[model samples]
Target: MNEKLTKEEIMAALNERHSPEKQALLSEGRVAIAGLGGLGSNVAYALARIGVGHLHLIDFDVVDITNLNRQQYFMEHLGMYKTDALKSLLLKINPYLDIQTDCVKVTEENIVDLLGDEPIICEAFDRPEAKAMLVNGVLEHFPEKKLVSATGMAGYGSSNTIRTKRLMKNFYLCGDGVTEPEYGNGLMAPRVAICAAHEANMITRLILGEEEI
Candidate 1:
């Protein structure tokens, strides 16, 4: 039999694992994800499990069998919009999570409206052009917002090379930043998740008032 967990009960359990002060910071954290593929999916999962109070999920893609190799979705989610599928999965983990999803492609015109209020933004687009678009859009429009982006996680490369780099005062990049799927063994679960973890950890640190990147 499955039992429904009350919000208080969930918080109580989280409190036992995380210090009250840490949980409070996480609960007050609000972030936006610009792609619901590999990096976004993993980052969302991490944030939800750690008690992020609010999340804005943005993606115009859908779950596909090809995504299973590195994404958070399962076979059951194939063909569902990424935002919808990820939101459903996340709610199962933290029922009280404030998840606002948009099933539309992120463009410069809509970027501000979609992520205006989120202090932290994660860029998880697949293509270099798409990643540039989001990063440029955010940097140009929301200069003060913290942005975490990834590159070069593709392939069965050395995990040690996957690192978090503080590019700007508020921008961080994770991964080897050199490996490309077109030239390597291609995207694998372990490396992708490793980079995603770096992004998630950076976001959490930012939420907890860590200034040293």
Candidate 2:
């Protein structure tokens, strides 16, 4: 990074060709992600690494020992809020990055407000009902915001099967939507990471305006 460049400026200049207008563009970009679980946690980490200027992460659930299997929270962070745990670690990775953390469950009533500011929305909720609520809420109140949702990724599967599908304009979903926790035989690390990567990849493309969704 250039000595004179601000964190934002350095990131902008560093990825100038792929990210135009320097910090100016990043300054205008913000992403809201619901759920800080196996999917959400990895998604946020990837976005932070990519130098997104701002992020709003939400999750009311507290970290547990089970989460260490696939989620980003550590053993030391047990009992910590997932949103708080993620925020604590993410900021350390990029102090210049702006993060707004909300330790609250995402329901239809609040999903709109929680997601209102960001141009892109990332759906990382593990439960089908909660994920559906967020998706429906977005479609109802904020129709234009780009969305990346993940589903059916519970079972042990090869990483290659996890892929991003452009469902429609501004809407992208990852994974085959086939696996379930009951039949998952159990969730493992690799599947979680693969699905998360697909979601994060779509998010980055949307942010850069490289893809419609």
TM-score of each: 0.98, 0.88
**Local distance difference test, per candidate?**
0.93, 0.82
Q: Give one digit per residue, the lDDT tens place, for model 2 in 16-122.
A: 64445543554566889898989989999988876787999999999999889999888889998888899989877777889999988887677767888888999
The ten-residue window of minimal lDDT in model 2 covers: 17-26
lDDT of 1 by residue, 33-147 (tens): 8898889999999999999999999999989999999999999999999999999999999999999999999887888888999999999988999999999998999889999
Clashing pairs in 1: none
Instruction: List the candidate 2 regions with Cα displacement exceeding 4 Å.
Output: 1-27
- Candidate 2 residue pairs that clash: none
- Model 2 scores what on Cα lDDT? 0.82
Among the numbered candidates, top lDDT falls to: 1
Q: Give lDDT: candidate 1, residue 129.
A: 92
